[model samples]
Target: MPAKPRILFCHCNYARVVPDEVKSSVLEGLCKSGQAFDAVADLCEMAARRDPALKRLAAGESPVKIAACYPRAVKWLFGGCQAPLNAEHTEVVNMRELNAEDATNTVLNKTLTPNLPADGSVAKVEGEKKI
Candidate 1:
């Protein structure tokens, strides 16, 4: 079986949009699932400075799900990485608006499920109501 995709969470250290407690709660839930993930202080800054972690992420062939701010910002942040980031292989969840539980559920559903479409976009699961 193929490995599950990586889940990256940005705490938005600089912007301070999502509450720390909320971010921590979501991170705890995700960690408990035994999935591969990284909860970083600031992915935007890391990507801006060409952090090695970004390079590593770019090199991998696995799909990536990012729990962060706006999708546009996430895309712009990682745009200049050495290894090109393919839009089809990436998904970004807007953490700014969601509560801890909803954010956690979103990440879990997006990363753990095997039913994603060819474009790597998440399809709504049957009977699953959006928070």
Candidate 2:
């Protein structure tokens, strides 16, 4: 079996779009589901500062799924980091608009399924059509 993608949940410390209780609920659900993940206070700032943890995450070959705000904002935040994250190998979940249950469901569905495109390309799970 392929390795499971790492799930990263952003608390959006500064913006405060995703509430702390929501984040906690999602994290607890993920843990109970046997999915491994990391909860970060602020992914944008971490990427901006080139934090070592971010570097380590970037260096990994496994795909990554980020649960945060808008997809565009996540992309912009990671843009300045030293290590490059190929767009194909990443996925973003819009936690800003989703409740804790919905966010957890999205993360679990993406990480636990064999949803990658047959062409060996990266795809984003946004709506009905995978991007």
TM-scores of the candidates are 0.71, 0.70
For 5-121, candidate 1 gives per-residue lDDT tens digits of 678888788976877766887788887988777778888788666676876765567877778877766665665444345666677777787887887788887554322223333
Off by over 4 Å in 1: 1-3, 110-131
- Tens digit of lDDT per residue, candidate 2, span 64-114? 887777776666555545445556677777777778788778877755332
lDDT of 1 at 118: 34
Predicted structure 2: clash tally: 0
Report residue 3 deviation for candidate 1 (angstroms).
Answer: 5.6
List the global CA lDDT of all models: 0.69, 0.68
Please give the distance, in angstroms, between residue 111's alpha carbon in candidate 1 and its true position after superposition.
5.3
lDDT of 2 at 130: 21
Candidate 1: pairs in clash: none
